[model samples]
Target: MEGFLQLLLNGTALGSIYALIALGYTMVYGILRLINFAHGDIVMVGAYAGLFTALAVNGPAHPDLFHFFIVLLAAMAVSALLGLFIERFAYRPLRNFPRLNLLITAVGVSLLLENLGQVVFGATPRVFPDIMPSMNWFQFGQVAITNQQVTVFGTSLFLMVVLEWIVLKTKLGRAMRAVSYSHEIASLVGIPTDKIISFTFAVGSALAAAAGILVCISYPKVDPLMGVMIGLKAFVAAVLGGIGSIRGAVVGGFLMGIAESMVVGYGSSTYRDALAFAILILILLFKPAGLFGKYQPEKV
Candidate 1:
């Protein structure tokens, strides 16, 4: 029982990170119907941004709360700008073209970002500065909980709540939902569809940035390619929960994380990565629309 509880706690922390990243995927897809494959790379970019900011502010040592906030904000800001740039330059012109074109362009942009990351950040992995002070917060029998896990889970939940508020309560969120429902209708209704789309990308990218930092806090490693596997898994989580459903993304992410943790604890770590793809396949076969996704009939 203690062992089970331990795995559950660890899974929840990891899942929250995946949830953060998956939210970006779901939000963009909900609004634009574009996968924005480059979204994952934005995580890498954000990690690098946070790393540099941390170094600039406190060198290699752990950061105080204020400095940590600064580092987080810097990463979010940089990633948000990059998201805007991608939407403006890479996606805008091709918007009216076939979706296949946009898809291909997204892939191209993803590759470009990965290669550029390799070139800019170098292929070598860098140690992410410890921004949050580490200590055990609680322990029971054989189960233990650390400050890092609490921070990751707490921070992620807070951000998710904020995002929920923005989507459901804010004027910008209303406009976003309107645009997501129907771009042509939203534009006709005097909503700035373009601006809304750009904002969606920005917000999603910022969340991804937060996820990147949270991952670094726990794992303490940064690399240009680090986002690849994690990003794929998050994408699976989005799909599993229902690609366009916010609630679904969160549920799917936790499920994926928990599943991974259970497998690692009770089974072999060798199959950990394969678990995501397996879940994807099962979800696709049994419920293509996902646990929270509703199917919409195409108008002919």
Candidate 2:
């Protein structure tokens, strides 16, 4: 029972991170119907930004919670700006182009970011500096909880709540919904669709950055190519939860995380990554629209 609880806790923590990343995927897809393949790169950027900020402030020394908070905010800001930059420079001009073109462009941008990151940050993986002092918060039988797990879980949940509120209750949320429903209609209704799209990207990228930092707390490493697999898994999470649905993304992420954790805990860890693809294939075959996704037939 203790072992089961341990796995569950670990799974939930992992799921929280996945959920954060998955939110970015679902948000971008919801608003633009264009899969931003580069979305995962934002996580890489965020992790680096946090690492640099922490090092600059207090090199090698474990930072306090407050210092880590500052680093987190800084990462979010940097990632948000990067998000805006990508949307404006890469995606904005191609708004009216074929979606296939946009998809290709997204792939190009992703590759560009990864290569550029390698050039700038190097191909060697770097150990993320310990931003927060590590300590056990509590232990119950075999289930021990750490401060890092608490922070990751709490922060992720808080962000998810804030995101939900923004998407469901606020004026900006209404605008986003309007645009997502029908860009042409939203534009006709005098909503600034471009601005809305940009805002969506900013928000999503910020979330990705937060996820990056949070994951670093647990995994304690970063690399230029780190986002590639994570981004794929998060994409799978979004699709499984029913792309374009915020709640669905969260649900899918947690499910994926738990499933992965179970596989690692009980079965061969070698097949952990394979599980995501396997789940994706099964979902696509059995329920392409996803568990929570509604099917919409495009008018031809």
Candidate 3:
């Protein structure tokens, strides 16, 4: 029972990070119906941003709460700008072209980012700073929870709630939904469709940045190619929940995390990575639309 509880806590914490990244995937797909393959690379960039920020403000040895928040904001800001730049320069021009063109462009952008990252950040892995002070928050029998886990989970939940509010309560959200339903109609109704799309990209990228930082907090390592595999898994989580459904992304993330944790605890660590792909295959074969996704017929 204690072992199960420990796995559950760990899984929830890890799932929150996946949910944060998955939210970005769902949002972009919901609005533009294009999978931004480069989105994952943004996570690597954000982690680097946080690393530099921490180094600039204070050395990694001293963990300060204020410095941590500053680093987080800096990373988010840089990521948001990168996302906006990608959307405006890479995607906007090809918007009217066939979606296949956009898809290929996305793949190209992803490769470019990965190669650029290797060149800029180097292929070597760097140690992420200890931003949050470490301490145990809970202990019961053989189960223990740390401050890092609490912070990761709490921050993720807060961000998710804020995102939900933005989508469901704000005027900006209403415009976003309008654009999602029909871009042409939304433009005709006087909504700034282009700006809305750019904003969506910015927001999504920021969430990815936060996830990147949180992951480093938990794992304490960063590399230029770090985002590749985790990004793919987050993409799976989004698909599992329904590509365009925000709530579905969160649920799918938790489910994937728990499943992975259980497998590792009760089974073999070697199969951990393969498990995600296996679930992806099953989900695709059985229910491609995902748990909360609705099947939409493509217009001829």
Candidate 4:
């Protein structure tokens, strides 16, 4: 039972990280209708940024929680700016191109970022500081939860809530929704589509950076390729929740997280990812639109 509980805790923590990255994918897809393949690489960038900041700040001395917070903010800011820059340079010009071409370009960008990351950070994995305390937290009957799990769970929930509020209540968010509905219409109505898109990427990337930092806390390492698997999982979560739906993204992330955990807990842990894909297949076979995503017929 303790073993099961341990797996569950780890699974939820992993799921939270997946959901964070997934939110970025879903948000960009929701607003701009672009996949932004490089977004995952941005999360990688955030991990590296935090790792560098941590190492640079306190060296191998293990910074405190306060220091981690500062490093997190710095990573978020850097990733957000890079998100905007990518949108302006890579995506803006290709906005009107064939969707196929745009997807190809997105892949190109993803590869480019990975290569750049390799060049800059090298191909080696760097160990991140264990900034969060490892002390045990409250127990759920027989289940022991650690401070790291609590921090991960709490932080993920807070970010999701803050994001939901921002999307539902803010004026910038209103502009964002308008653009999502119809970019040309939004432009006609005085919404700056470019600015809004850039802002959307900024928000998405910032969330991803936070997720990356959180991931580093648990996983305690960063590498150029770190974002690849996580990115794929996040994309699956985003799709499972409905590609363009924010609430769906959140829902899909946790669901996928739980499903993967269950699969690992009971069956072959190696097949955990296969379980995620299986769920995706089932979702597509029956719903087609995703669990939280609304289906709209294509215009002929």
lDDT of each: 0.93, 0.93, 0.93, 0.85
Write model 3 residue lDDT over 16-46, tens digit each, in one string: 9999999999999999999989989999899
Estimate candidate 1's alpha-carbon lDDT, on a 0 to 1 scale.
0.93
Q: Residue 254, candidate 1: how far off, in angstroms? A: 0.9
- Per residue, candidate 1 scores C-alpha lDDT tens digits across 221-265 of 999998888899999999999999999999999999999999999
Cα lDDT, model 3, residue 293: 97
What lDDT is obtained when candidate 3 is compared to the true structure? Answer: 0.93
Q: List the residue pairs that clash in candidate 4.
A: none
Question: Which candidate would rank higher by lDDT, 1 or 4?
Answer: 1
User: Superposing every Cα of model 2 onto the true structure, what RMSD results?
Assistant: 1.0
Error of 2 at 5 (Å): 1.2
TM-score of each: 0.98, 0.98, 0.98, 0.95
Q: List where candidate 4 sits over 4 angstroms from the true fold.
A: 1-3, 59-63, 140-142
lDDT tens digits, residues 159-239, model 4?
899888888899988998999999999999999888998998999999999999998888888999988777888888998
Candidate 3: where are CA atoms >4 Å away? 59-61
Clashing pairs in 3: none
Error of 4 at 45 (Å): 0.5
For model 2, how does the per-residue alpha-carbon lDDT over 1-300 read when each residue is reduced to its tens digit? 888888888999999999999999999998888999998999999999998988888835756878888889999999999999999999999999989999999999999999999999999999998887788899877789988899999999999999999999999999999999999999999999999999999999999999999989999999999999889899999999999999999999999888989999999999999999999999999998998899988897
Query: How many clashes (backbone N, Cα, C below 3 Å) per candidate?
Result: 0, 0, 0, 0
